[model samples]
Target: MKFCYACGSPLIMKDLEHEGEVAYCEQCRQYRFPIYHSAVSMVVLNPNEDKILMIQQYGKKDNILVAGYINQKESAEEALKREMKEEIGRSILKQRFMRSEYFPKTNTLIWNFAVVIDSEDLSQVSDWEVDKAQWFSFEEAITQVKPDSLAQRFLNNFLQEYKIKSKDFFA
Candidate 1:
Protein backbone atom coordinates (compact mmCIF):
# COMPACT_ATOMS: atom_id res chain seq x y z
CA MET A 1 0.00 0.00 0.00
CA LYS A 2 1.46 3.32 -1.08
CA PHE A 3 -0.97 5.51 0.86
CA CYS A 4 -2.62 5.31 4.26
CA TYR A 5 -6.39 4.85 4.35
CA ALA A 6 -6.75 6.91 7.53
CA CYS A 7 -4.82 10.14 7.03
CA GLY A 8 -4.19 10.17 3.27
CA SER A 9 -0.47 10.21 4.01
CA PRO A 10 2.20 8.33 2.07
CA LEU A 11 3.14 4.94 3.48
CA ILE A 12 6.51 3.23 3.49
CA MET A 13 7.72 -0.24 4.30
CA LYS A 14 8.75 -0.50 7.92
CA ASP A 15 9.76 -3.68 9.70
CA LEU A 16 8.10 -4.13 13.08
CA GLU A 17 9.09 -6.96 15.41
CA HIS A 18 7.30 -10.17 14.42
CA GLU A 19 5.72 -8.35 11.41
CA GLY A 20 8.10 -7.96 8.54
CA GLU A 21 7.96 -5.11 6.03
CA VAL A 22 4.55 -3.64 6.80
CA ALA A 23 3.08 -0.50 5.33
CA TYR A 24 3.71 2.21 7.95
CA CYS A 25 2.15 5.65 7.80
CA GLU A 26 4.48 8.25 9.22
CA GLN A 27 1.79 10.88 9.67
CA CYS A 28 -0.60 8.50 11.43
CA ARG A 29 2.23 6.69 13.24
CA GLN A 30 0.62 3.32 12.67
CA TYR A 31 0.97 0.22 10.58
CA ARG A 32 -1.81 -0.04 8.06
CA PHE A 33 -3.04 -3.56 7.52
CA PRO A 34 -3.64 -4.81 3.99
CA ILE A 35 -7.10 -4.38 2.59
CA TYR A 36 -9.01 -6.96 0.54
CA HIS A 37 -12.59 -7.66 -0.45
CA SER A 38 -14.44 -10.58 1.07
CA ALA A 39 -16.80 -12.85 -0.87
CA VAL A 40 -18.82 -16.06 -0.55
CA SER A 41 -18.91 -19.18 -2.73
CA MET A 42 -21.04 -22.27 -2.53
CA VAL A 43 -21.30 -25.90 -3.44
CA VAL A 44 -25.08 -25.63 -3.60
CA LEU A 45 -26.82 -28.94 -3.06
CA ASN A 46 -30.33 -30.11 -3.84
CA PRO A 47 -32.46 -30.99 -0.83
CA ASN A 48 -31.92 -34.64 -1.67
CA GLU A 49 -28.18 -33.91 -1.47
CA ASP A 50 -27.57 -35.69 -4.75
CA LYS A 51 -26.59 -32.87 -7.07
CA ILE A 52 -24.93 -29.44 -7.16
CA LEU A 53 -25.78 -26.26 -9.05
CA MET A 54 -23.13 -24.80 -11.32
CA ILE A 55 -23.27 -21.72 -13.51
CA GLN A 56 -21.80 -20.30 -16.71
CA GLN A 57 -21.11 -16.60 -16.45
CA TYR A 58 -19.49 -13.93 -18.58
CA GLY A 59 -20.02 -16.19 -21.62
CA LYS A 60 -17.52 -18.71 -20.27
CA LYS A 61 -18.13 -22.30 -21.31
CA ASP A 62 -16.87 -23.86 -18.11
CA ASN A 63 -19.42 -24.26 -15.34
CA ILE A 64 -18.47 -22.83 -11.96
CA LEU A 65 -19.82 -22.77 -8.43
CA VAL A 66 -22.17 -19.86 -7.63
CA ALA A 67 -20.32 -17.03 -5.86
CA GLY A 68 -20.68 -13.36 -5.00
CA TYR A 69 -19.12 -10.69 -2.85
CA ILE A 70 -20.38 -10.22 0.71
CA ASN A 71 -22.25 -6.96 0.94
CA GLN A 72 -21.28 -4.34 3.48
CA LYS A 73 -22.61 -5.15 6.97
CA GLU A 74 -23.57 -8.66 5.83
CA SER A 75 -22.40 -11.86 7.46
CA ALA A 76 -21.03 -14.70 5.35
CA GLU A 77 -24.17 -16.74 6.02
CA GLU A 78 -26.32 -13.75 5.03
CA ALA A 79 -24.32 -13.34 1.83
CA LEU A 80 -24.74 -17.03 1.06
CA LYS A 81 -28.50 -16.79 1.20
CA ARG A 82 -28.57 -13.52 -0.74
CA GLU A 83 -26.31 -14.87 -3.48
CA MET A 84 -28.42 -18.00 -3.94
CA LYS A 85 -31.61 -16.01 -4.28
CA GLU A 86 -30.05 -13.42 -6.54
CA GLU A 87 -28.24 -15.77 -8.89
CA ILE A 88 -30.18 -19.03 -8.91
CA GLY A 89 -33.62 -17.97 -7.69
CA ARG A 90 -33.51 -20.46 -4.85
CA SER A 91 -33.59 -20.01 -1.09
CA ILE A 92 -31.02 -21.85 0.93
CA LEU A 93 -32.70 -24.44 3.13
CA LYS A 94 -29.58 -25.26 5.12
CA GLN A 95 -25.93 -24.31 5.06
CA ARG A 96 -22.60 -25.57 6.45
CA PHE A 97 -19.36 -23.66 6.17
CA MET A 98 -16.47 -25.65 4.68
CA ARG A 99 -13.52 -23.27 4.55
CA SER A 100 -12.02 -20.13 3.05
CA GLU A 101 -9.34 -19.36 0.50
CA TYR A 102 -7.87 -16.15 -0.81
CA PHE A 103 -7.40 -15.46 -4.50
CA PRO A 104 -4.63 -13.06 -5.35
CA LYS A 105 -5.83 -12.27 -8.85
CA THR A 106 -9.15 -11.00 -7.56
CA ASN A 107 -7.82 -9.87 -4.19
CA THR A 108 -10.82 -11.53 -2.69
CA LEU A 109 -11.00 -13.66 0.46
CA ILE A 110 -13.73 -16.19 -0.28
CA TRP A 111 -15.71 -18.08 2.34
CA ASN A 112 -16.86 -21.42 0.96
CA PHE A 113 -19.91 -23.34 2.09
CA ALA A 114 -22.08 -26.32 1.30
CA VAL A 115 -25.72 -25.31 1.13
CA VAL A 116 -28.91 -27.23 0.41
CA ILE A 117 -31.79 -25.65 -1.48
CA ASP A 118 -35.44 -26.64 -1.65
CA SER A 119 -35.95 -30.02 -3.33
CA GLU A 120 -39.23 -28.96 -4.92
CA ASP A 121 -37.67 -25.89 -6.47
CA LEU A 122 -36.40 -27.48 -9.65
CA SER A 123 -36.67 -24.53 -12.01
CA GLN A 124 -33.66 -22.19 -12.10
CA VAL A 125 -33.40 -18.76 -13.71
CA SER A 126 -30.01 -17.18 -14.09
CA ASP A 127 -29.39 -13.59 -13.14
CA TRP A 128 -27.89 -11.10 -15.56
CA GLU A 129 -24.35 -11.99 -14.47
CA VAL A 130 -24.93 -15.68 -15.04
CA ASP A 131 -25.77 -16.68 -18.59
CA LYS A 132 -26.73 -20.27 -17.74
CA ALA A 133 -26.76 -22.79 -14.91
CA GLN A 134 -27.24 -26.52 -14.54
CA TRP A 135 -27.13 -29.29 -11.99
CA PHE A 136 -24.57 -32.08 -12.19
CA SER A 137 -23.95 -35.30 -10.33
CA PHE A 138 -21.11 -35.14 -7.84
CA GLU A 139 -18.90 -37.19 -10.09
CA GLU A 140 -19.64 -35.12 -13.16
CA ALA A 141 -19.17 -31.85 -11.28
CA ILE A 142 -15.72 -32.92 -10.21
CA THR A 143 -14.77 -33.30 -13.85
CA GLN A 144 -16.85 -30.48 -15.30
CA VAL A 145 -15.34 -27.48 -13.47
CA LYS A 146 -12.56 -25.55 -15.17
CA PRO A 147 -9.12 -27.05 -14.63
CA ASP A 148 -6.78 -25.23 -12.23
CA SER A 149 -9.32 -22.52 -11.50
CA LEU A 150 -10.38 -21.08 -8.13
CA ALA A 151 -13.82 -22.68 -8.31
CA GLN A 152 -12.29 -26.05 -9.03
CA ARG A 153 -9.87 -25.64 -6.17
CA PHE A 154 -12.59 -24.66 -3.71
CA LEU A 155 -14.86 -27.52 -4.83
CA ASN A 156 -12.13 -30.10 -4.59
CA ASN A 157 -10.97 -28.91 -1.22
CA PHE A 158 -14.48 -28.83 0.18
CA LEU A 159 -15.39 -32.26 -1.19
CA GLN A 160 -12.21 -33.79 0.14
CA GLU A 161 -12.81 -32.31 3.56
CA TYR A 162 -16.43 -33.30 3.43
CA LYS A 163 -15.49 -36.87 2.56
CA ILE A 164 -13.03 -37.03 5.41
CA LYS A 165 -15.73 -35.77 7.75
CA SER A 166 -18.14 -38.40 6.42
CA LYS A 167 -20.08 -35.91 4.37
CA ASP A 168 -20.66 -33.33 7.12
CA PHE A 169 -23.75 -31.50 5.91
CA PHE A 170 -24.37 -33.20 2.57
CA ALA A 171 -24.86 -36.58 4.15
Candidate 2:
Protein backbone atom coordinates (compact mmCIF):
# COMPACT_ATOMS: atom_id res chain seq x y z
CA MET A 1 0.00 0.00 0.00
CA LYS A 2 1.27 3.47 -0.85
CA PHE A 3 -0.58 4.99 2.06
CA CYS A 4 -1.77 3.67 5.39
CA TYR A 5 -5.45 2.90 5.60
CA ALA A 6 -5.57 3.53 9.32
CA CYS A 7 -4.11 7.04 9.47
CA GLY A 8 -3.50 8.26 5.88
CA SER A 9 0.27 8.41 6.34
CA PRO A 10 3.02 7.51 3.88
CA LEU A 11 4.05 3.88 4.17
CA ILE A 12 7.58 2.54 3.90
CA MET A 13 9.13 -0.89 3.84
CA LYS A 14 10.06 -2.07 7.33
CA ASP A 15 11.66 -5.35 8.32
CA LEU A 16 9.30 -7.53 10.33
CA GLU A 17 10.05 -10.79 12.06
CA HIS A 18 8.95 -13.86 10.05
CA GLU A 19 7.14 -11.56 7.61
CA GLY A 20 10.24 -9.91 6.14
CA GLU A 21 9.79 -6.34 4.83
CA VAL A 22 6.25 -5.04 4.99
CA ALA A 23 4.51 -1.78 4.37
CA TYR A 24 4.85 0.20 7.62
CA CYS A 25 3.21 3.47 8.44
CA GLU A 26 5.17 5.76 10.71
CA GLN A 27 2.09 7.70 11.80
CA CYS A 28 0.04 4.62 12.53
CA ARG A 29 3.07 2.65 13.68
CA GLN A 30 1.76 -0.51 12.10
CA TYR A 31 2.03 -2.65 9.02
CA ARG A 32 -0.46 -2.50 6.18
CA PHE A 33 -1.34 -5.57 4.20
CA PRO A 34 -3.15 -5.37 0.89
CA ILE A 35 -6.71 -6.59 1.22
CA TYR A 36 -7.89 -9.28 -1.15
CA HIS A 37 -11.30 -10.89 -1.43
CA SER A 38 -11.88 -14.61 -0.93
CA ALA A 39 -14.19 -16.58 -3.19
CA VAL A 40 -15.17 -20.22 -3.72
CA SER A 41 -15.20 -22.21 -6.98
CA MET A 42 -16.73 -25.62 -7.55
CA VAL A 43 -16.13 -28.43 -10.00
CA VAL A 44 -19.69 -29.71 -10.09
CA LEU A 45 -20.03 -33.39 -10.75
CA ASN A 46 -22.73 -36.05 -10.90
CA PRO A 47 -23.19 -38.89 -8.42
CA ASN A 48 -21.15 -41.47 -10.30
CA GLU A 49 -18.34 -38.95 -10.80
CA ASP A 50 -18.37 -39.57 -14.54
CA LYS A 51 -19.50 -36.08 -15.54
CA ILE A 52 -18.41 -32.51 -14.81
CA LEU A 53 -20.58 -29.44 -15.11
CA MET A 54 -19.59 -26.11 -16.61
CA ILE A 55 -21.50 -22.90 -16.86
CA GLN A 56 -21.48 -19.79 -19.05
CA GLN A 57 -22.30 -16.58 -17.27
CA TYR A 58 -22.41 -12.79 -17.72
CA GLY A 59 -22.89 -13.36 -21.48
CA LYS A 60 -19.33 -14.64 -21.59
CA LYS A 61 -18.51 -17.02 -24.40
CA ASP A 62 -16.18 -19.18 -22.36
CA ASN A 63 -17.54 -21.92 -20.12
CA ILE A 64 -16.38 -21.40 -16.55
CA LEU A 65 -16.75 -23.27 -13.32
CA VAL A 66 -19.41 -22.13 -10.86
CA ALA A 67 -17.98 -19.70 -8.33
CA GLY A 68 -18.95 -16.87 -6.02
CA TYR A 69 -17.54 -14.70 -3.26
CA ILE A 70 -17.66 -15.89 0.33
CA ASN A 71 -19.97 -13.72 2.34
CA GLN A 72 -19.08 -12.35 5.75
CA LYS A 73 -19.44 -15.00 8.50
CA GLU A 74 -19.64 -17.78 5.91
CA SER A 75 -17.04 -20.53 5.53
CA ALA A 76 -15.49 -21.46 2.19
CA GLU A 77 -17.47 -24.72 1.99
CA GLU A 78 -20.66 -22.86 2.80
CA ALA A 79 -19.91 -20.36 0.04
CA LEU A 80 -19.30 -23.14 -2.49
CA LYS A 81 -22.47 -24.96 -1.51
CA ARG A 82 -24.46 -21.77 -1.72
CA GLU A 83 -23.02 -21.01 -5.12
CA MET A 84 -23.91 -24.53 -6.21
CA LYS A 85 -27.57 -24.15 -5.32
CA GLU A 86 -27.82 -20.55 -6.48
CA GLU A 87 -26.12 -20.97 -9.84
CA ILE A 88 -27.32 -24.39 -10.88
CA GLY A 89 -30.44 -25.00 -8.79
CA ARG A 90 -28.98 -28.11 -7.16
CA SER A 91 -28.00 -28.88 -3.61
CA ILE A 92 -24.56 -30.32 -3.18
CA LEU A 93 -24.89 -33.88 -1.93
CA LYS A 94 -21.17 -34.37 -1.45
CA GLN A 95 -18.08 -32.23 -1.72
CA ARG A 96 -14.32 -32.38 -1.28
CA PHE A 97 -11.90 -29.50 -1.00
CA MET A 98 -9.48 -29.29 -3.91
CA ARG A 99 -7.25 -26.25 -4.17
CA SER A 100 -6.92 -22.51 -3.86
CA GLU A 101 -5.64 -19.93 -6.33
CA TYR A 102 -4.94 -16.23 -6.10
CA PHE A 103 -5.97 -14.03 -9.01
CA PRO A 104 -4.12 -10.72 -8.90
CA LYS A 105 -6.24 -9.20 -11.64
CA THR A 106 -9.44 -9.59 -9.66
CA ASN A 107 -7.79 -9.38 -6.24
CA THR A 108 -9.55 -12.62 -5.36
CA LEU A 109 -8.38 -15.76 -3.63
CA ILE A 110 -10.48 -18.71 -4.84
CA TRP A 111 -11.00 -21.93 -2.89
CA ASN A 112 -11.95 -24.75 -5.24
CA PHE A 113 -13.87 -27.93 -4.50
CA ALA A 114 -15.18 -30.97 -6.30
CA VAL A 115 -18.89 -31.16 -5.54
CA VAL A 116 -21.35 -33.93 -6.27
CA ILE A 117 -25.01 -33.18 -6.83
CA ASP A 118 -27.94 -35.35 -7.77
CA SER A 119 -28.41 -35.65 -11.52
CA GLU A 120 -32.11 -36.45 -11.18
CA ASP A 121 -32.76 -32.78 -10.62
CA LEU A 122 -30.36 -31.55 -13.28
CA SER A 123 -32.68 -30.84 -16.21
CA GLN A 124 -33.81 -27.40 -15.12
CA VAL A 125 -30.52 -25.55 -14.80
CA SER A 126 -31.21 -21.85 -15.14
CA ASP A 127 -30.36 -18.99 -12.82
CA TRP A 128 -30.47 -15.27 -13.48
CA GLU A 129 -26.70 -15.17 -13.14
CA VAL A 130 -26.04 -18.23 -15.28
CA ASP A 131 -26.65 -18.06 -19.01
CA LYS A 132 -26.20 -21.74 -19.73
CA ALA A 133 -25.04 -24.91 -18.00
CA GLN A 134 -24.06 -28.28 -19.37
CA TRP A 135 -22.55 -31.55 -18.33
CA PHE A 136 -19.51 -33.08 -20.03
CA SER A 137 -17.54 -36.29 -19.69
CA PHE A 138 -14.31 -36.17 -17.70
CA GLU A 139 -12.25 -35.79 -20.87
CA GLU A 140 -14.70 -33.33 -22.35
CA ALA A 141 -14.80 -31.28 -19.13
CA ILE A 142 -11.03 -30.97 -19.19
CA THR A 143 -11.40 -29.51 -22.70
CA GLN A 144 -14.57 -27.40 -22.28
CA VAL A 145 -13.48 -24.79 -19.73
CA LYS A 146 -11.44 -21.77 -20.89
CA PRO A 147 -7.82 -22.70 -21.47
CA ASP A 148 -5.07 -21.31 -19.21
CA SER A 149 -7.60 -19.94 -16.75
CA LEU A 150 -8.09 -20.61 -13.05
CA ALA A 151 -11.25 -22.58 -13.80
CA GLN A 152 -9.26 -24.82 -16.09
CA ARG A 153 -6.45 -25.21 -13.59
CA PHE A 154 -8.81 -26.10 -10.73
CA LEU A 155 -10.72 -28.63 -12.80
CA ASN A 156 -7.50 -30.22 -14.04
CA ASN A 157 -6.09 -30.57 -10.57
CA PHE A 158 -9.25 -32.15 -9.15
CA LEU A 159 -9.68 -34.61 -12.03
CA GLN A 160 -6.01 -35.64 -11.99
CA GLU A 161 -5.98 -36.13 -8.23
CA TYR A 162 -9.31 -37.97 -8.29
CA LYS A 163 -7.94 -40.46 -10.79
CA ILE A 164 -4.96 -41.24 -8.62
CA LYS A 165 -6.98 -41.52 -5.45
CA SER A 166 -9.71 -43.59 -7.04
CA LYS A 167 -7.16 -46.13 -8.21
CA ASP A 168 -5.68 -46.38 -4.77
CA PHE A 169 -9.08 -46.57 -3.11
CA PHE A 170 -10.15 -49.39 -5.38
CA ALA A 171 -6.86 -51.26 -5.06
lDDT: worst 10-residue window of model 2? 162-171
TM-score of 1: 0.87
Q: Estimate each model's TM-score.
A: 0.87, 0.90
Clashing pairs in 1: none
lDDT per residue, candidate 2, 1-171, as tens digits?
688888888999999999999999999788898878999998887878788888899889898998999999999988887777777888888878887989988989999888888773555666688888888999998778999999999988987888889644222
Model 1 Cα lDDT, one tens digit per residue, 116-162: 88763645666687888888988999999988888898889867876
Q: RMSD in angstroms, all models?
A: 2.4, 2.3
Clash total of candidate 1: 0
Q: Candidate 2: give the clashing pairs.
A: none
The C-alpha stretches of model 2 lying farther than 4 A from their native spots are 123-126, 167-171
- CA lDDT of each prediction against the hidden true structure: 0.86, 0.84
